[model samples]
Target: MALRIVSADERLSAAGAKTTMAIFGPSGVGKTSLLKSLPPAETLCIDLEAGMKSVQDWPGDSIPVRTFADALDIGCLVGGVNPSADPSGFFSEAHYQHLRESYPDLVQMIAGKRIIFVDSITDLTRQAMAWAKTRPEAFSDKTGKPDTRGAYGLLAREVIGLLKHLQHAQAKTVIFVGILERVTDEFNRTTWQPQMEGGKAGRELPGIVDQVITMSLFARDGDGWRHEPERGEDRRLVCRAGNPWGLPAKDRSGRLDVTEPPDLGALLSKINATRKG
Candidate 1:
């Protein structure tokens, strides 16, 4: 194979490609509710967490994923209607083959849309971990239990693989919702971060997406409690666009407000405007 080189102009032209954003926060922080505001006609949500109850009143298209197989089948369009293999046995060769075959279809599906959202990457990680535990290869014969180290390694690979697939899809934008996890450092200070099941995925996640936003609650003096992005008198959900208070975040577009209401459409519009300028 010969080395290929691209011109600076070509590279700069591709720099304006669409973005993928990851949003994470504590439960009840309105992560799911934020999706309701996205343009329903242009967005499709894969509800892996089955937490659409928050957006039940919102008119949009969503698919609830019950099992790991169900999630893969929906996202990748493989493994038929009902998979006979145990969900925990996802590491099997057959499952890998199915994943390989379905990737092209997944790319096609994402290419046909402007926005593809996955509700709760944390829950997806949980599903992957659960599957890893059931794999006999990850179990310790001496203890008759799954080996923690082995299981976590498998979980990380599975979660990262799926995330990589979504990241590389042809959709104009991709959004991953996740829960927040509180971690205590050596200084005894607790900081919130994305709740990725395996430590590896949590570390790798921020590098894959163009943005990492944290949805949080804010209190305004005597206003009791309100969302971080609330601008009016009433409390509403909001997002922290860039890194704040040790939270992992990035605003590649550099046009988003540090704290703004959770509106995907507005975010995209601002990015597009910036690109045009």
Candidate 2:
């Protein structure tokens, strides 16, 4: 196969560089409210959790993802198909054609949007698991009984494949907003993670995206501790990895401070800024 080397000129054009990020926070942390901070004209939200009440007044478009099938179709619509995938495999060109036939205007619906927003992966995982339970893989061949382990395996493969497909949408930015959960172990040490049904997707998601941000309410003193907002404190987006607090975050662009204002548009602008001399 002949391959042409990409030019440095193309590399420096940040406008063409696509970004995939996951922003996680606890419930009622205004994760959905971040939608208003993005440019409405260039953003489209895939509302999987029915959590648009917070952004109801925002002048942006969103598609309600009520079922697992809708989620898959939308993913395929936005990400396109994997050309190298097996013809009969999931999310192959054959599946793409089926989606096109079903939703003929899907492309036109999101043609002008530069950013594809997913409201919450926590609920998406629930939907995916629900669908996985009905499939043959979720049943044990020996007993023909339901097997949660098999279901989770299928869920992991489907969700990860779907995420990778979205990551390959190289011309548009993709953002997945998810709920963050706090867990304490035997040592009573608290750790944070994305709240999803299956463990595999949450664990592997950080490596798949360009950025892993934690949107949380923190102390104004930069102490890396959560503070009550009722005390008139502020919330910040934790962008960089390795901090006193165990919030999960990473900045691949290397252009962000440890904490940044909770605004999506400004965050994206900073990430896409070109290097200086």
- Local accuracy by lDDT, each model: 0.68, 0.87
Give candidate 2 regions above 4 Å deviation.
14-16, 222-232
Inter-residue clash pairs, candidate 2: none
For each candidate in turn, the TM-score is 0.74, 0.94
lDDT of 1 by residue, 39-129 (tens): 8877778888878887888877777776665665554432121233355454334664566575765545544566778897888888888
Worst 10 residues of 2 by lDDT: 223-232
Model 1, residue 276: distance off in Å is 5.1
At residue 207, what lDDT does model 1 achieve?
84
Evaluated at residue 44, the lDDT of candidate 1 is: 78
Q: Which ten residues in a row are the worst by lDDT in model 1?
A: 76-85
Clash count per candidate: 0, 0
**Shift in Å, residue 20, candidate 1:** 1.1
